[model samples]
Target: MDTLTTTKPLATYVVRHADDNLVLGQRLSEYISWAPELEEDLAIANLALDHIGVAHHLYDYAAEVEDDGRDADGFAFLRDERQFTNVQLVERPNTDFAHIMARQFFVDAYQVPLWDALARSADERLAGIAAKAAKEARYHLRHSRMWVLRLGDGTEESHRRMQAAIDELWRFTGELFEADDLTDELAAAGIGVDPATLEAPWRRTVLATLAEATLDEPHETVMRTGGRRGLHTEALGHLLAEMQFLQRAYPGLEW
Candidate 1:
């Protein structure tokens, strides 16, 4: 198996994970004042903060590995769209409450297992970050899972919306488990977990949740990909434009 046994690939791998959390966190933050209820708004804000905090640590570690003079903020706010390696799933727009819940459910299911396995990594810092992140991922999963169940089983309109969200988001999920040379090499060196290993567990949890909610499992479809390779949907570019605007407008300004 090809491996990412070099410094660059390792840094890239770490940064990709950071990018995933950062982008998704930003998306979730958009719901802070827009959530269905005041309590829900606070809940979503806290969840977004959780992801952003994890991203900060991961990006810091990646910067240290890369030794590129850039810091966590640079990686998070200054990079161009092509520089991001997060899977396309996290970058898609949150169209509605149902769409947001479905996206969170899919991502949290994958993240729970990914972080759990990474918590045992041979690299000490990576392991430490994973250990912390695994805890947050568990909470994220629980929150998202409950919302999925509520939306999927609640009212006729909610059920229809939840199913639509599931169908629309399902295609992007394949990238979560798609292994590439970077992962193969990192896994071989005990620096990273092969994402493919998390797939079975993710499916089981997602399927069980859907079943209990009375939601149908979406039929397998041709998966849209490329974010792992620095290619992404137009949506990501727009997301970045907004996210990076502050930094771009004021190159080195600080509060």
Candidate 2:
């Protein structure tokens, strides 16, 4: 790792963070009218909005770093699938309530620590964004943790579904901590936090939550990769097709 002498790593780092938030936010939005309960629908919508808000701020900063004329909307709606660097976890489909909760739980666990560390970044703009995002991440973590408990310890069917969700999604979790040249450079420069550093604390929190929920932790298995390298699962293609449709069909269309 070395100090970042160029803005490339910084912009890429910010873009990766933005991609994670935006993709997960979009997935959460799919539950707007489909949540099991009306109150739950509102809650999920608000959470999705929080994530999108974080993405907007990060994208705005990234645009400035790249010295590009593109704005937040451009980054959000114009990028092709191969340009996104979000982890494979967030791009997965929300198969069910249990699956959604499991995904959120894993992500928020990582995000809380990530944002906390980023709040101390040498880059002031990034620090500010992380400070605000850290607050939202805390709330998101709490919400998802409660759901994991409720579903994991509830009725037999609920318990089964929660376990299944955990098992299915566990493989994707490892990619959250994978480091690359961009992260390595930024982290050494104190402009970004090394994601690998967050793993131990994340595991502690997640394991405790699972224990309280009476859920068995899934065994470590073959891990998924390549999202950071601009490769993605099939789900992301479908997601981008729907999400970028309006913008792609009518470029720069404004309300």
Candidate 3:
């Protein structure tokens, strides 16, 4: 017997991360056909696929803990947006290339530490999943960081766009490090990593990357909150509606 503690509490943790990626992946997929050019459209589509792939992988792990026969597809397609636990950061629309990179960079930085830590989770299954996913997160961060560096140091226009995106998106980031009741529950069960511990390494990685990119880290501000407790931006409900539309309208529907 594995004799490992349950990953049920860890489901709360995994769902938050996976749901965020799933929602964001859906948003990016929306932009695929509308990109300025075929090449750009293809690039957008590729990124969308990558995000969705990760989302599905995480969801599968979450479903494993459900023990109610709900698989990844069931969990993903069946839930309403309001019921989703993804952060507000992932729900934001992809405004531009810079905007997309900015969002990805912020999440990817935190994800690296998170998944790396989860690789050793007391829950055996989660630890295995984390070990595999951490590598994917690493590649994701690398891709986003390279784009950030290029855009920040490229032409004047690119720099302006990148900087604007950074400022606009930075406010939502505070939620990533915010610990709450659910976090407390999971942490108590040895299934979750402490958000506070993630902050230092996250800061180090982010600052070092921004400095190398020749971009000035914006001044620390008051910071924004919500998302973990389901208090999300206005955009999330609409997104959930679309994402869950088919599932809601046609229960038990499958491809």
Q: Per-residue lDDT of 127-167 in model 1, one digit per residue for the tens?
A: 99999999999998999999999999999999999999999
Instruction: Tally clashes: model 3.
Output: 0
Looking at model 1, residue 69 earns an lDDT score of 90
Model 1, C-alpha of 24: deviation from truth (Å): 0.3
lDDT of 1 at 91: 93
lDDT of 3: 0.79
Cα deviation at 110, candidate 2, in Å, is 0.4
Q: Which whole-number lDDT from 0 to 100 does residue 147 have in model 1?
A: 92
Stretches > 4 Å off in candidate 2: 1-7
Tens digits of per-residue lDDT for model 3, 1-255: 211112366666787877777887888787777765697677667767767887788788877776778888877876654567777888887788789888888988998998898888888877887787688788878878988999898899999998898888888888888888767777777878878788888889888988887788887877777676666788888877887888889988878
For all predicted structures, in order, the TM-scores are 0.96, 0.96, 0.87
| Candidate 3 error regions (>4 Å) | 1-8, 33-46
Query: Candidate 2 on 24-60: residue-level lDDT in tens?
Result: 9999998799999999999999999999999999999
